[model samples]
Target: MRWSALLNPGFLVAFVVLTVSAIGMSAAIRAYGLHLQKLEIHAPGNRQLSALPRETPSWKQIGTDQIMDEDTVKTLGTENYVSRVYIQKNPPAGQEPIALEFHAAYYTGGIDTVPHVPERCMVGGGWLQTKGAQTLALEDVDTSTWIVDAAASGGARGEVYSVRTLPAPYSDAPGTRVRLPFGVAPDKPIHMRISAFGDPKTGKTLYSGYFFIANGGTAASAEQVRTLAFNLTSDYAYYLKVQFSSAGVSSAQELAELSSSLLGELIAEIMRCVPDWTLVESGEYPPDNPRRRTGASN
Candidate 1:
């Protein structure tokens, strides 16, 4: 073809039309494929953790009206989020009571929607993070089995035992190894931190542990959250951020121990009520599935 002929208006229009049509067709195909796969792009209801027993032999729920203020809730994305606060009951006479705060958010977009990392939030509030975010290796126990066994036996409900101890300073030390529970191990969750606002002498100190759960599993890092959200074979896209904090903790080691114990129990409680990923993936509720009974309790 001659160069002048190729530059004709009609020829250029035809070329542009073909290019646009090809791109449009490609996009349409992708969209249709996603639809066929039945990807879950929104928060799923009836998946929130049930109201933990109001009064257990070991701990009693302290009635609290609010977990986060309206502004904080709005900042965390109010589309799908739940928060609860509880206190440890009947501790040794002199020990300060331990307080637990749990917050979970199902972000459809991605991990970026989750907000208020302790490092940032503490600093923003004029509190200094004495220890930066670090991965504390937690014991990998099959929590599903534990829940079933506990429920069946009517033993101490949600009692979890750890074979290993969490180290001090909350850092991934040389001998540290992360235990994989249920063959699902994500990035290491940041260990509870100790933060002080001003002069260490007079400032109040708080110990806190925070982590995220995605697709019925817990992850400690943003990268892990992305991994679960973007899994190709699974359409389960949800993130749950759980945080527990307390004051009057003596040392980081003590706080780490307390956090590990509380986290294990809390995860078990959450998994008991969270929707089963198998049913969610299939997009069908089988009458025989145990998750049907456990998922929508409250």
Candidate 2:
């Protein structure tokens, strides 16, 4: 018998609600199925299919040359979704800061565009200054967001590494390491000291430890990627260092706003570090920084 028939018009309404409740329960169970199964030492293999598309690429490779160099330091913010807070210093020509729209992987648009290149963490607004001058306030925006790279570490036998190698504008350079100076070891949890500066218009600075799994190109195992994300989430906290031009001038509202904004950005950045778990084209896509184009035209 059809389950909806048990109740007349009135009963039918109740039956619909019951059916919805059942569906919700089922969804909840499925979401945490892995967690539950592990506790009971039962392997829930093939119990449910993964939501990710099987056809998704293995890794996203940017030619390490597509990122704009002039906008070297960008704070990607994610409050409701991904946002960009780019800081520029004398951008050449094509390197002028531009804000492209952010689209999430789960979001549906006319066309299925891959999610924006998510950053590991938001390194709050940076200090823009000349060699001999103090940092100045150029541009500031609302708190922004960045994506966490959770899948880089192909689980199990794979390794995850975070680096801060540098030469200034490192994001746009191919095969360049600015500083391996700061990063967590493979399988270690991610942590960082986040700092910020604010004023009437000047925004804050947000920084965090780098955390990415090394999914050995085409040769990585699934376990390797999973382990990388697992280790990263273990240590998650925002150490925000507040930078202010003049102390006590700004009221609590201003300071609170800045603080809250910084925190939100931090969370979004961490999310980016999480592996997309989807395959993507691999290659170094460098940013088109005009400064790079001007050959010796400082």
Q: Which candidate number would show the highest lDDT if scored against the true structure?
A: 1
Q: What are the per-residue Cα lDDT tens digits for candidate 2 across 178-210?
A: 111112232232221122333224543222111
What tens-digit string does per-residue lDDT give for candidate 1 at 22-116?
A: 99987986654332232344323454443433333334456653556788767766545555656666667998777655455556544345445
Model 2: residues >4 Å from true position, as ranges? 1-80, 84-90, 93-95, 103-156, 164-268, 271-298
Clashing pairs in 1: 192-208
RMSD of 1: 11.0
Q: How close is candidate 1 to the true structure, as a TM-score?
A: 0.61
Q: Please report how far candidate 1 places residue 164 from its true position, in Å.
A: 22
Supply every candidate's count of residue pairs whose N, Cα or C atoms clash at under 3 angstroms. Answer: 1, 65
Once superposed on the true structure, which residue ranges of model 1 sit more than 4 Å away at CA?
A: 1-50, 67-69, 79-84, 90-96, 109-112, 140-202, 232-236, 285-298
Q: Model 2 — which ten-residue stretch has the worst lDDT?
A: 37-46
